[model samples]
Target: MSSDRQPIPPTRPTGHQIIAPGHTFATVSDKISSIVLTRRTPLYWFIPFLIASALLMVFLVAVTALLVRGVGLWGIKVPVMWAWAITNFVWWIGIGHAGTLISAILLLLRQSWRNSINRFAEAMTLFAVACAGMFPLLHLGRPWLFYWLFPYPNTMNVQPQFRSPLVWDVFAVSTYATVSALFWYVGLIPDLATLRDRARNRGARIIYGILAMGWRGAASHWQKYETASLLLAGLATPLVLSVHTVVSFDFTIAILPGWHSTIFPPYFVAGAIYSGFAMVLVLAIPLRAMYGLQDLITMRHLDNMAKVMLATGEIVAYSYIFEAFISWYSGDKYEMFAMWNRMTGPYAVTYWTLIFCNLVFPQILWVKKIRTNVVWLFIVSVDVLVGMWLERYVIIVVSLHRDFLPSSWGIFHPTIWDVATYVGTLGLFFFLFFLFIRGLPMISIFEVRTLLPQAEVAEVEQ
Candidate 1:
């Protein structure tokens, strides 16, 4: 190769040379505050908030009726005791897992792309978990005694059964929720401080300042914050795995033929991520458009997320196939019958819907053109979420409807309360998410700014 044609050596910056004037870290703090805080909240913010609030009121009314009247108002009966309540519980919990996976797991993996979305995803996780935690408690007809699920000294001298998967669910979900909140709040400290400084009024400043916990941009503070975050991430990874594993156990450990399975742990985890990411995309697309964050939450971010959705979609497909193979290989007549029932029996419509939504629609993402198209990505994400919900319904309802005893075989249906609450939960999730976006930064300003290429080069030169 000619000398001029040879690869040019990378230029090295000299020490203490000013690349640009007034480039202090404080400037970054100010820029972020300006982007997030507004003089008055936008009208678009009120739409989700109002709708969510209205739905939440309806949920309260329905729940009160359930408490006053009893579980009889629900569609639950013999051989179908577990209906929409448990389905909603599991589905919401699964959706909750996505936020932690994006925020904690990807952070440890050093996936730089996570910087743009992790904060909001973390918030989504917290709110989803909050919405999810309600179902298990309320599913107990007497919500008053729901606390008995926890281990504490009781007059009956009975301890919560450690052997029961439901108890395990109690512990796992509680731990996951608590740890996720701490992690999300800890990450927000620096950004909150930025807000504290930028607040136009004394009340807002005081509120943000207190929440900031006296955070300063000192090197020592960042070091400790990062170390704490890393430790929390380590703690959170296994917690995430165990939480969903326990959820799977709730079904798998049952003696019902269709419920028993060895493949549930990984399968459930993959499904959780798949649905969680779908919710993230659904929320992100709207927020990006609403907040004028198109540049920060860019097409590149959507493309990367679509790739993840497609990969997990395939994993779920594999789980579906493996379930079929195992059911056939076991040669248990009841198991085979249960599988057959799902495909061609009473609820075949729901079964086909699951396949079409979860397995087929996601395949579109395999096309590079489809993955990058914002409208297509949004549509596919919504489709995947619906499919995942149906998948959970299929697993729970189908298995329970036709357990070992042929005499117990029956079809289950949901009542108006069931549909109302499901819609209400969606409202709750979006309501919390809307508040988070309008009141706090939807994108992680600190993390995104750090991802700028110039900042990376500057850090290296230093």
Candidate 2:
């Protein structure tokens, strides 16, 4: 490690200081603020931001065409009624789960390391949900009539098919999005106040001031803030399970052979968290280097997150084995064929690719050096994302493509629009993230302050 990486303090252990030594409360604030206020956007950030912007334009044009021409522009048809759009929806929703795990679940469990990473993780969650939320709305063929999915007083007097899993999806995703946004914004309040206090210009001062909502960092204010955060964490923990479980319901509730298993709920939830942690590492490694955040987000954090990826990935691997085993064990030929088709059918390459991506690659993480190394960790993270996506493709498209009647079997191919919409959401996610890094304190300033040794000594004295 370079000297710039971190200078160890004599009193502090290798893992201590969560924030490096030699930082006071003011310095912590200054350090994070310098990233946003003092530093110019580096070429590293600018190039990706520019690319994301260009892709956002492609997304807009693609979506406009989708609305104008209807669902026919995509390759979705009879046997593969739900294809790329639903796959992307599930994939994005899964990616969002790590945010909730880091922010809500770990907070409840009293993981102090979560402090440095949770702010950005929560932001990623909100954006991932945004990307996830778009697909189902667009899937509503007429989309303009999507409000009909809600309960409303109407002359026709129809309500959403309350029992349908897709309806459950509407409720689950919307509730998750709402809670995630609220949770993220509430966490931002204290940091926003920091920005407000430090603002050099009137415009920024006023904008951040308004958003700060009179937070003066008083004892009473902090008491109320902590109380609100605990309550929100309680609410959000269930959502971490509920949102993806309901998403899995979109498949398990069906009579389709591969989709009908009871294991789908936990299986999907594990996969969601699995992919989410991967994405966080994927984003964090590059970011830690670019923004010089290695000290704050240390190798310890990387090692821990990599351990999480390996463990949850093992669960996902179990689900894969059980899915195959149960399909073969059951006397149902349809179930048998769905499993076989996934392994040996027309899209066999995708199924095998998914296995390699999800299973083969993550095995490298068990080697301690690789898990702790950014380059190796980043490669594995990208593979996890690809594998999880291919997992969705296998589940939705492969199962649907070869169901029931032999005569009806057909393959689903994404049109330019399908590919564009998925890529566009990536563009949008990156764009939002770039804006986030630019405007806000990416680390929780107050939380990191709490980790300082002096704060702990003060608490002990009190």
Candidate 3:
């Protein structure tokens, strides 16, 4: 008997569509711009913003205390001179990587999915770098003289010690922040123009119009905008690798046993991407749910992000194993002891937990169910973040606590001040993020509009 049903035509995979169907350019713009332009703000928005503000206050208090009492307020000790401050610094820097990777490298590759998420990811980078920049300054005993880190022609003629990795960080992080800010703002121009046109109040239009810098959507304007974006993306792509690699240099160039290995550059880069993606998810999941942006963000973005976490997590896992193997294989007693100490030392619980968080927990992502499940993905993202923090703690504190001389071995415990400073940075990050989402379109209005079918049609016509 002949089947009544004709063979079903092979269908394209809908699993990774960047934007949901049935949306047009008008809807995309209205939905996104309205979030910023709405007369009445949502109750949910205020709750997190208030919490972040409170935390930002705590950060200010913590910084004030540090500046007043000096670095003595922190838990930094003799051998563990680098404690929470350095750990937080490195962690925040690493966290900034995903934004650059998603915004720049992926943009270069012409990955259309990035259009939905790149705006806030770039914001996250700027915010995280801001938080990271604060640590090194505070870590300097005389934070008042922070300008000394910069090279300038001055009366005193004090030059930053060029040999110090600390000096390199100043240049690296500053350049990263500058380029990232430009890239973020350039991307915002078109969106700002949209907001300017869409705003009802004259004041709102004036503000956005000023930021838009008189964007009229002319053909020449589009041509110039595309060129600037490409140039910035090209500049920023290397920063994704360079920033973290330079960060790794802070450890590798040192004679410290755990930090001396050549594997650190790639290892840190992989770990940065791993944690950065986790953070992106951590932010994306709640925001999407809160704003009812499911159609715009879609599970496809979440799934792709999770897959990235998995691939980077594998690399991180390999780095951990290689780190230990090299320590043992080097035949240096210091290296062997460092590895042994990490496994069986006072901070052994932290090490094992890091392993579970960075390696074991993320493995579940290989299963598609976990990758697609928002709640599970969020939890795993959090786990990876914590694991990455613990990894830094293990690398810095654990390694330093037990040095070559037994007499130098001393435990590092974070004082309340240390905890406050760290928690305060967390506050600062969220606070900036809260303000960003409220004031600007968290999703790019113009970029997301480009993902619509109409854009493709318009492009073909052009």
Per-model TM values vs. the true structure? 0.92, 0.95, 0.95
TM-score computed on alpha carbons, candidate 3: 0.95
Per-residue CA lDDT of model 3 for 1-462, tens digit only, reads: 135844321111213367899988899999999999974689998999899899899999999999889998887889899989989999998999999999988877777788889999999999999999999889989988888889999999677889988788888999999999999999998899999999999999999999999988998777677767878888898877988888988998999888898999999999999999999999999999999999998998999999999999999999999999999889999999999999999999999999999989899999999999999999999999999999999999998999889988898889999999999999999999999998999998877777766664222454
Q: Give the alpha-carbon lDDT of every model.
A: 0.83, 0.89, 0.90
lDDT for position 1 in model 1: 23
The weakest ten consecutive residues by lDDT in model 2 span: 6-15
Instruction: Choose the strongest candidate by lDDT.
Output: 3
State the RMSD for candidate 2. Answer: 5.6
User: Which portions of model 3 miss their true places by more than 4 Å?
Assistant: 1-16, 458-462
lDDT per residue (tens digit) for residues 282-380 in model 1: 988887787666656777778888888888899999999889889899999989998999999899999999999999878989899998788999999
Better of 2 and 3 by lDDT: 3
